[model samples]
Target chain A: MARITREEVERIADLARLTLSAEEAQALTHDLDTMLEYVQALDGLDTQNVEPTAHPLPVATALRPDRARPSLAPEEAVGNAPEREGSAFTVPKVIEGVES
Target chain B: MAQRLGTLSELRAALDDGRTSASDVVAQALGRARELAPAFAATRGLRADRAAEEALQADQRRTARALRSVLDGIPLLLKDNLNHRGEPTTCASRILDGYVSPYDATAVERVKAAGGVVIGRTNMDEFAMGSSTENACDQPTRNPWDPTRVPGGSSGGSAAAVAAGIVPVALGSDTGGSVRQPASFCGVVGIKPTYGRVSRYGLVAFASSLDQVGVFSRTAADAAALLQVISGHDPLDSTSLDEPVPDYAAALDGDVAGLTIGLPREYFVEQGVDPDVLERVRDAVKELERAGAKTCEVSLPHTPYAVATYYLIAMAEASSNLARYDGVRYGHRATGAHDLQSMYSRTRSEGFGAEVKRRILLGTYVLSAGYYDAYYRKAQQARTLLRGDFEAAYRSCDLILTPTAPEVAFALGERSADPLQMYLSDIFTVSANLAGIPGISVPCGFARDLPVGLQLLGPALGESLLLRVADAYQRRTDWHTKTPPEAS
Candidate 1:
């Protein structure tokens, strides 16, 4: 069975918030399919009883006392923003007619 | 400087005995960065002003007999992905245009706390993707041994910088053999410590689960000197291990008596690997046996599934991690956006390189609703089995030995066209990351006049033992001391 199609690749690009050119979409369709086929080696493994491992080490939530500490100044936080007005980042209009 | 700067220890000795001043050493390192830029293209930019100021402080502290540590006054390079306060952490990608770090990465902060001088930011594969540095926005870093060949990457610049003698030590992040493969190609020592062994606060997540900051140096001891300063728990990084930091330098007793080094039967097979590279690794094992270490053959049945599993997990994590680069808060923004959604898509599409996009797309596909169970979940279960392989192997041996890469560095653009071929170059090194164990790549010998890396792996928090074995083998052989003729 075909693992993915060019249309699916374009859908994935959309899902990833990336707009791909037609050439890029076609190329990635082939590349992603090849990689998906290669990864089929895992189909032979018996992982039915095996538990999944998201992290290599056991992790516990790290909690500290609630207290305000020194943090990045507002200007510093927005210093690299493409467009900022008074320590706030300006983005494209989010709502239907409201300015953002 | 009166004496030639070779290793961190040698430079420290020179500084202690008044052979060279800290300012002069920093000047020499900065000068080398500029002189070698055209040939290697290793660093993004040199921090000449900051280095001079830090060197002066180090000298004043030395005069007061308040020398901080082994890293004090030592000039070193940081991979461009890592934040260095005021410096731009580009990750060698155009997506991060006009962005500068507001705070220091935990590793960088620790190094600065010890008075270590930051010399420059080294180039790397964009977002620590790709086995070769060719995926970067900047010119690829070439191997110092043969300028026409590639320095294996995404940490290729750090490896090349150390190999070419631009600096004694450099920092790089290893998600899937980024540091070690490049180190092997460049004939330097690269070490990826156990997961959570080093803090990842400002390292810029490539794969949050597998990413760990690593070191590249000419010798294990020099790596140890820098690793010591950078390792330890940081409250900033929740995943950072809270365990006590070991005395890495003191562990280098050059003694490997009674240590059992396991050689994975799968990795030593006749096919896939270059014959000469295998021979060098076998000879390296024999040298270790001569120095009082025992060898055994072990099986990691899940070895064949590592590459697939590694990519699945890495890409899934990368997709999520890279979603932050959508141009709203920082980094490159599209010029003309009619709406918010197009702005994000256009910014990312324009900013990311080919490889980065390919990975993001694959990652998105794997994690999508329909394919999640078949791909991502299955790969995770296989990851558990893979870790079990290491756990079982470690019961019989204290350390595992293998070739770092199947072959030496290939010519530039040789494997760039084939992503699978380039991904396979990391075959021998990625397993350690998947298992979240410590592994080191040390120069064993040469093949076709190119460096071959002999890898040594240990279980979780086994850095001390791994370093001991590597330090012992390096002591017995001159491979670690051999410098590129062009570099010398």
Candidate 2:
């Protein structure tokens, strides 16, 4: 029964690391409100004791024995990197945009 | 015309007979693509040199007594998301702009092994996150049927390319109706193979478990050929099936005498499905009845919650899968790095589009502390009921029938303004992904001159049976071969 507020939407965007323009935040607030309203239809279903299913297939708890598997060379793994520096995968830093 | 009147069958025949060259076919397709490019804007990546190499090899095979398979020397298009070796696989995202894959997807490898030439990669909704092509980061692919209207997405380009006669067949992926929706709008045959029937290795993971490789073609037979070539086990993808590939093309001949087709009661009424599209679907069902198949009105009791549950699960997977795109260890990196947060924030905020950002935000929140049990876990429970609805329907029928998309293609800006309206475009499609079943969309009829598709959804690994039913319908109807009006 709780409505998605503008602040909640803005905060969620912040956590998502997205800088939302006011229009976007306002639009998402309205959209998320409608979405939650529609999603709430499932709340009325009688699933009190029923267990939730994660995957549809019958996957058992099994793994190949812990034998040494052939490993891709570091170069092989780094070969596909869009940014590589001396055999190590290099990446752009993102966290510093927010002030400490 | 895109090419001469030969169907995919005839096209492949000429290739095998050495009467046509693969390079020639690619050249012809590329020429048509250039001519019709204004109509649908159907392409994203055009691999001219690689296609030339493939055509040369195919030419050698034609000269010798070598035949690879039914797909030999056939030029095909791939949606932008599927990884291709030596070509950029951008998935229509700025972050991945200029990013290239070093290996081919298992499905791509299999298609090439069958002697099919990958001529180009088509456009799509950025990260396959939207129902209309308007969400594409670059240009929106137009519907060949109506130049001003959209080709449905996120597989719009694949559909338009095939519909415009640019390629007899193309590869597409369906997470939540990506292939089938556009297949309908473009009036082509689109088949989303049963989950794991085709390996997803190197597909760039948009909601991993829900994503399955599918195909788009002008006919059911073309789709069958593509599916057979790509269906098999790969040691690389654990989910790939080891089951023997069935004779899908051969299975097309089986009579539909004893088949029970389910007409879901909810899929027809007040669910916002357009009446004209529903009417065409009903006519297709009537045609099936005339083919000696019986029809039953069935119920998928939990049909209403399908979209919500689909979004929850897909977003959860997407948030996890997209986590790998962090600006480290590969992909686009912002040059100015004051700190780690700045790096991630600038990279992601700049890298992703609005829809992708929106979904990621929603997904992250649902999986965040305090809300996981309520939203994410509850949606998982609803998913079980949604799957059960399909299972119950199947108990009374061999396959269930419905309209592929709610309506035919809308104008470019019609649904672009409202994301929710676009989400509703997938109401009839999301359930199949929820259940991980094989679903196909066949050209049934037109609504207001644009194409409408009749969807046939079948059980897991039921590709053979599904194709037979579709083939029967296709044989009885010429709608599948009916090209869009504007393309003509």
Candidate 3:
């Protein structure tokens, strides 16, 4: 079985920045164990020499003509914005961070 | 009024024959929508006034070229994550409450140009994450079958709308079974075309590679009617396939005789799959076999890792895609923040729900620098193994079969207590996505009154064959025609 340890759970929580309730966290531990235990089924299969296929269709360098059609007015695009400033939809600033 | 009949093709044929005007159809559809919305929670922000006005012009000489496609005069509910001009595309997330779209998605425009009346936006998961509509930060969309139970999600509203007879067809996005799972749960025909078959231009991305825009309808024929209008190349979405879209409705009755159908032995393993659901799917396969399709017991040995692989990849893409949701350009921002970092932190923290945050965290860790090779890379390799398994299975069979989900709809909060359990709901549906192929869910039967979906998964570019078999199976059974409790 692929053992999912408490440290891994804490690490996943830290990386995801989740403030889990004691109950939710404990519940997640058991569920994750179940998930990993079940997923252990993959480890039994032989994939020794299989070259990974990423893109379904082969990559092509052929390019298409760049075209610009009518654009939705700024007001229309930002109309779904829960918060806005002028033509822009305002959101929290993002940058470098080791968020939990 | 009879001109604007139940099926989309019938409605379009009526328009072609000078029976009723598009305006009349839109008005009637709007009236019905108003009548049904309260009971089913199918739509938000109905655009009857706008749809009726635009549809009136369909008869004018100006829109002649646009009305030539299969969907002329048909109206559809676009799940809210898909942006349409002048429509609120909220994705059922409180973060975008009352938001409006400045532009129409390539898919939306294609349907509209084919003379489909842009009707209204349907409710969905906050960002297309959960299986039940209960995840919507807004209101949960009720199942038409049993209002107390859920219409599967994250496209719950789209399925509910069509299931309740409010609309003949609607668009939904599938990432780990959002479209097909719900179609199965709602007992409707749901088709997730090949991953690149439709453009994702105006769709708010959930999981980039796996997110596919699909259609839901009362029957495979109706779904084909909608697909014929929506599937095409779009310069807007780089990932959209440039190939020609087949006339799905024209090709509806393609021969299924002698086609090989693979029954994946692994999919039947008890991870939580209900026995009744399994039996119904087996019964559906027997029907297909009776119709001349050969059934073979096959194995997708790596099927067990699908859920884990799907979550890691989907969450990784989600974290990256949602990075653009910072306050300045799109989405919501917190009320106050002392500095830039705090502003981003608090806004994101407050904006996303617990599940979404949990996914983002899991995603970030899997893709983290040190752990990349072990978690992310290993999963990608497993994806390769999974695809190889499918390839080997397909060599023996033309199409594969399985139950769309483990069981029918769980009560709203039944699995919400554990996110892993919630994610497990998608186990069966995620494999096709990993391989970038097409899969669809057709109503198998009801277990305790809730519908079970019989999933038909096909090789890449295998939709035409898949639909033909599904249509054939549906023709022999009345399952697809059974309306939910709300409709009755």
Candidate 4:
């Protein structure tokens, strides 16, 4: 296992969409390094030809009827939104250059 | 002493015989909860007025002799992770600070339909991530037995409430020993049903594959009553099993004669286990043997790898599941963000606690480029071998008995400083979640005056057998009957 560095911690935090302070990044680098070291015990075990068990039960994805019945009203759907315009949620511009 | 609020069956009989009104029962429970709240910090949100109205309706139904089920008129607390309509489902995380659920979790709906009163929501670790309630956004819940020590978590509040005799039962989500370990620490009965046995539709997902809503109660029979109410298939939860649901309470006859119970040597004689906890569990096995149940030693050779495998898999799933909590649609949003990207990053950084953020970062790292095959995939493959180990062991024994936790509850901040040490606390209980089996932790005896739980694990969809064995052991012991001094 490779040692986790502060730069690596910052990169992982970026991928996770979380912003870390310099102090937090330094601390997490140490924590993740230790955790990775602990989990490296799996490297000794030979899992050759073994399939991964994602879900315990062997169930296929359940599909529902295509027809729409009762569903949440638009306002109810966005009821907990921090900002909303009319019946839809207001975000900070997904397509920055384009105007609606 | 004030008359103890009895178990579900006793409360039901009281309502049926007109000895006590449901209104009075709810009032009594709310009062007791309020009295103990300052000391234990068990409850986060209490629906006192709504609970009173529900109790009135229950009392009217009792007069008309039209009861919904055994849970009718019983007051129970829900772990904060469960969504109840119009109530905040915080999962004890600031990210969900002011969000109110628009609909009930399937388990909550079933409990309400069965006439169980939703008295309040209990405290837990933030996003069910920690072994102690200290991770909660609210103040940590202390053990009812010893105020200086923690009531094991992320279901700490529910366990504390039940141990304090404020409620007969409560619902909790157990991703990895959240329910069972707390119950063990607090001297109560907690049941984590087979992964698909109970629907997880409205539960705030922690680790999708590992998370299962479970029950905490004073007795195995009460846990069974609550489990039966919540267990079944739900179309909303695709992973829910379509198997036939059993009357779990009816199956609890306390008969263990001629049954084979496997004592997993890995857990009992393990190096990290406290001698006192091991001794009490061994004594409980002997007592069960005297009651005609056979005991045999079994080995789950891959037991040591359970913690490592569980954290990797669970953190990966948590990272994916928690991606939905971006700032736009719901939950807490960050301020002064000029762009969309900054909005997400700042919102998450501000909203999540240290532990939740750590897991998310670690999870992202493991699933990122180059490390996926080495960490995530390997953990999953090892999980298969661990599951196989359980299957091989169960072939010879009806149920596996082990200590729920390696030791009794420690002081509140003892293990909080070290995350790896905190993670190891769930060592004995994580395997059942990994293997998707049902396990119950019942109070066996005391270790240094604090309670120790004896864990009984059964194969998939084997809740009835697990309950039967636990109920049998409970019938021969009075450990569950010993209430905390503060509660008494």
Candidate 5:
């Protein structure tokens, strides 16, 4: 049986950067277990020599001429930013000890 | 007044013959949209002034005898996931609160260039995640046929709007049956072109590989009209195919003679599917047969594993694609965070609903260390076999026919509590997405007073053939003409 423990659920949630309440975590643990069990049906298929198909259609990288083009203005780009200073998007500090 | 506006072609004729003005049609459609938006929660926002301006431009074009295309002055709705410049595109999620798009998606840009006025943006499952529209941060979109039931989602609002007769056509994105299922539920025609047929430049990414922009219309010909306007290669989206787009409407000669359609035996079985839905689909096939199309039985033995494979791939891609919504760039950002980590976690948890969180968690679990081979890799391999099934089946058949969904629209809260049950609702439609083929759902008949959809799938770049068959069937049946009484 494909099973997910509460600890495993919390770990996955952390990796995904999601904050879950204890109740939501427990419920998710059960739901994940149920879904995992369902997807286990893929084990029945004999895909020993089959190649994994990541894209439905074959894709080729499109190339364009290296020419200067007008891009989104700084003001236009940052128009939707919730926290902005001038034309830059403001964010919480990343370094351990950094001055604002 | 709302019900009087016919299909896109009819509207085009009306414009050409000076029987009606673009302003009159757009005004009437927008009026209906405003009147019905509250009851069905079908529209997230309306673009009254922009639509009026566009209509005025179209009228000027008509006066100068310089119409842009058949879609000139035609009013349509866009799913909220598509970015329209200077408009709020929330995708019915709290995360994108107050975020106005700085540019238009390629499809939106094309429609505007063709003089198609945007009446509004429709509601959808946040990030197009669920089978029903109930997963929205805003009010759930209810089925116009029966207000208590759901309009199948995640393009539920687009389907509902078209089915409600507010607009003749709309644009939606289909990843694992979002467009077709809702179109089936709402008794409209929805088309998911080949995976790379339409450019995905400004579409909010849910699952990158599986996502494709689709269209919902009142008829196959109307779908053809809109699909033609928006399809073709775009340099912005590298994944878009560069092949020439055929004349979709012209290909619909209303002739199905000499066509051989394959019916997958696995899908027609009595188990798990509503017997009534199967019957209606069978009857639809019989009608096509009567019109001289040949039928044969084919086996896509891998059909049973499609839903599982679809969810794995879709969620994995969604997890990766949705990582951009961190508190840094744009969208919702939590305040008073001591660290960047807390800001991200708090912003996402506060912004996303329960379903989005669940998918992200499960997606992360599958792609994480020690489990990638067992889950994500295996699903990708399974996807190969699924595609192979279609490739082999197409050898002897021109197209494949199946029921678009397992059942008609169920009550609003019926499957919300159970994610697995909700996933199963996409059984018949996801295979087309997995194989990267084209599929169209047309209204067939009714079960329990709700619309049933008949799905026709074709090989990659086979949109012309699929539309031909769909238009032929629509010509023989009047089901597509029936609108929900709720609109009246």
Candidate 6:
């Protein structure tokens, strides 16, 4: 039985960087457990020699010329940013004790 | 009832022969879109004025005998996930509530270059996460066949728009049956090209590996025309295939004589499939056989594990892809955050809908330490087995046929509360996506007064063959000719 505990759910949520309410966390425990149990059906399949296929089609990483080309203007690139200052995106400070 | 417009080819002929102006066609389609809004809820927004201006340009080009392909002056709707410069590219999510794209998607750019006027953006599931369109941040798109039922999603709005004749063709991104399932429900033709066949440059990522931009149209020929226009290699997308794209429209000779089609026994006997849907699909096979196509039974032993494998991989990728919406750059940002971490968590919590959050959480769980090998890795290996199944099956057959979905469109909110039930709706369509093959859903027949779809899948880079079989079936059946009463 693939049972996910409430603590485990909270830990996963933290790792995912999602803020969940107490109710959401509790409900997610049940949902996750249900889904996990269902997918466990795959556990019975014999895949001893099978290679993991990460991509559906076989594609080698494509390389392109390194020459610089015209790109989006800074103003246009950050046009959708919720907070911006002079073509730079403004965000909450990452380091504590840092001066703005 | 509003009178429906003709197919893309018919419209093109009208424009070329001076029977109707591009402005007239665009105006008429916009008028119908507005009138059908309450019943179908297909369009999230419209660009009627801008479309009219583009239509005038197209007419001017026609007058100068300089038409740009058959798509010149044709109006089409874009699934909202596709970026169009200066237009809102919300993937029907609150996170992207007011986000406007700064450039056009590669597909959108190609359409514009061909003189196709962008009419509007259609609604979809929040971040293309759900089977039904109910997850949209805006309103749910109703099936044109029955307003009380849902138009299957996350391309429901695009399917509904095409099914209702609001536009003859529309672009939709298919990740695990998003395009085909909705097209089946709405009684329109939808095609998902081989993975990497269509460039995903500006498409909002759902599950990057599984996502492929597809097309919806009233006929296979029309779908072919549109696919030909938007397909081909794009340097901007590293994953886009570098193979030469054939003339898909010309490949539609409506002849499938002596072609071998394999019917996977597992799909027909699956537990949850509606009997009527299976019967309709069987009848379609019989029709194809009578038209000189040969059919044989094949076994894809690992088919039963496709749903589980698809979800695990899709969610895992979605979790990683969606981490970009961290309230730092574009999209919705939360207020009252004291730290960067809080800003991200709170903003995502406030922006995402239920289904999206659930997938993200599940994805995180599978990829987390200790459980990674048990779930994520196992699913990946199983995906390889599933792909092997298709590869082996294709060794004897040119194409495979199955039902596009388990059943016809269901009522809104019917399966909304049960996530697993909703997930099962894509059972018949996801395998093609998993195997990276070309697949198309063509309206086959009606069941219980609703349309049913017959899906045809082909090998990788086999779009021409898939379209040929579907076009031939369409020529023999009148199901694609029937219009929903709401728009007739």
Score chain B of each candidate by TM-score: 0.99, 0.97, 0.95, 0.99, 0.99, 0.99
Name the docking class for model 4.
Answer: high
Candidate 3 lDDT, A1-100, residue by residue in tens: 5355666766676545444556656655665666555445555645566665555555455476778777667775565565677777554444547452
| Alpha-carbon TM-score of each model against the true structure | 0.99, 0.95, 0.88, 0.98, 0.99, 0.99
Worst 10 residues of 5 chain A by lDDT: A91-100
Candidate 3 wrong stretches, greater than 4 Å: A1-53, A61-100, B1-5, B13-21, B59-66, B269-271
Fnat by candidate, in order: 0.91, 0.51, 0.37, 0.85, 0.88, 0.87
Taking the tens digit of each residue's C-alpha lDDT, what string does model 5 give over B1-488?
45535788888888888899999999988998888877999999998998999999999999998989989999999999999999999989999998899999999999999999998899999999998999999799999999999999999999999988888899999999999999999999999999999999999999988899999998899999999999999989999999999999889999999999999999898999998999999999999999999999999999989999999999999888888888777789988888889999999999899999999999999999999999999999999999999999999899999999989999999998899999999999999999999999999999988999999999999999999999999999999888788775
Interface RMSD to the true structure, each candidate: 0.6, 2.5, 3.7, 0.8, 0.8, 0.7
DockQ of 4: 0.85
Superposition-based RMSD of candidate 2 using all C-alpha atoms, in angstroms = 2.6
| Candidate 4 per-residue C-alpha lDDT over A1-100 given as tens digits, one digit per residue, 9 for 90 to 100 | 5588888899889999999998998888989999999999999989999999998767888988898788778888889999998888897877878876
In model 2, what is chain B's TM-score?
0.97
Candidate 3 falls in which docking quality class?
A: acceptable
- Candidates in order have lDDT scores of 0.92, 0.84, 0.78, 0.92, 0.93, 0.92
Task: Give model 5's docking category.
Answer: high
The digit string of per-residue lDDT tens for model 3 on B88-194 reads 77777755654567778888988877777777988888899889877787678888888778888889999988887767899999988999988988898999988
Instruction: Highest DockQ: give the candidate number.
Output: 1
DockQ list for all candidates: 0.91, 0.48, 0.31, 0.85, 0.87, 0.88
Put down candidate 2 lDDT per residue, A7-75, tens digits, no spaces: 988888777766677887888787777767777777787777666767655444434567877755677
Question: Compared with the real two-chain complex, what DockQ does model 2 have?
Answer: 0.48
Stretches of model 4 off by over 4 angstroms after superposition:
A97-100, B1-4
**Residue-level lDDT tens digits of model 2 in B1-488:** 54533557978777667687777887887778777777578998788788878888887887786968888778888999888887889888888866777678989999888888888889899999988777888789998888888889999999888888888899999999999999999999999998888988988798887899999988788888889899997877877777789888888884999889999998888557788988898899899999999999999988888888888888888877887776775567666766666677777877888888778877877888888988889988888888888888888898999999889999999987677778889999999988889999999998888899989999988998888998889889889767666665
Model 6 Cα lDDT, one tens digit per residue, B80-193: 999999899989988997899999999999999999999999989999988889999868999988999999999999999998999999999999999999999999999999
Ranking by DockQ: 1, 6, 5, 4, 2, 3
Best by lDDT: 5
Q: Which stretches of candidate 2 lie over 4 Å from their true place?
A: A65-76, A79-83, A91-100, B1-6
DockQ of 6: 0.88
